[model samples]
Target: MAATSRPKLLAGRKVLLLADFQFEDLELMYPKMRLEEEGAEVSVMGAHPAGIKYTGKYGYPVKSDLCVDNMSTTDAVASYDALLIPGGFAPDYMRRNQAMLDLTVAMADAGRVVASICHGPWMLCSARRTDGSPLAKGIRATCFSACKDDLINAGAQRWWTASSCRAGGPFITARTPADLTPFLHAIIDEMAK
Candidate 1:
């Protein structure tokens, strides 16, 4: 029998990427490109408005096409199939923004796919469910070693140090820049389903 070809994994799906100043360059760009390659439409969303530009940790500038604060319509979170939070010092600042937290909570509560790497879980911890629960409370996750304490305190039950990536439910997390490959693959796998 002739083998049937498979369609693009994430065709017709939309993904939202959240970030702020000092985002890790590779973590954000790599997955964005990969997602596009798999036929997913990816939008870069920041803490501010569309005109705002965020510089990456290595000096790359990424301008936002969508902003958390600009999402006033009720269907904002419903428009995307998944949310990706790239790591770096950006997460530290992102976690402090009420609008950003609200967006994350909406995504998590809607059961949309969420992926975080390095320091990205900082936002996840802060912007959990709408009832103010921490998304990591009982989820297995991995982030930069420095974030272990905060992640646990924020309620991650098991913080994996030996693994580069962990996926629980609709959430996926990676340890560091070295794990970006597996991290993207995990997100792709999630979206494929």
Candidate 2:
């Protein structure tokens, strides 16, 4: 009998995940695990200082490997193949930092994978490219129903899709926690590419 093969589709790929206070527990954890299973290295960065623990809305906790402030160098940022932003109140807090927004824009401008789930899309709506263009502008997107208006106001085009819609760059988004499976799969697919 033939042995089953395990897929390490994202072997050698590095992914950066952004989180802060009140991140969605499942949104951050699910991707970290799933992506690792596929052989991707995932780094969690907090909007605050490094080494501090951040709690999710449901009270789950995650330690920050580094602060977003430390990802300043071109080489440091360039090492990542993709970025993941998990939803929750975290987006509301993370979105306030210029570094977080700049990082999002840089990842998108490079056409790398930029994925956000649920309220995570708030970062997408807030990021601005070097050209002064809104990151959400002219992109097909979907998010939590409450955020629908925010995206629209930010110039994002609405798309009804089961999984995710392409962002202003090589972006993807899911509407809620229920969509984590599909959202995680979308991130894997893009990173795999």
Best by lDDT: 1
Model 2 scores worst on lDDT over the 10 consecutive residues at 160-169
Candidate 1's TM-score reads 0.92
What's model 1's lDDT at 55?
A: 94
Score residue 41 of candidate 1 by CA lDDT: 96
Q: What tens-digit string does per-residue lDDT give for candidate 2 at 8-100?
A: 999999989998988989999998998988999888998778889998889999998988887773654579999899888889988898988
Q: Show the lowest summed lDDT stretch of 10 residues, model 1.
A: 69-78
For candidate 1, write residues 1-193 as lDDT tens digits: 9987767899999999987999999999999999998999999998787968889999988889987877852476669999899999999999998887777777877789989999998877887675667877878888998888878887886656868999998889998899989999999998988
Q: Which residue runs does candidate 2 get wrong by more than 4 Å?
A: 1-5, 160-169
| Model 1 CA deviation exceeding 4 Å by range | 1-6
TM-score of each: 0.92, 0.92
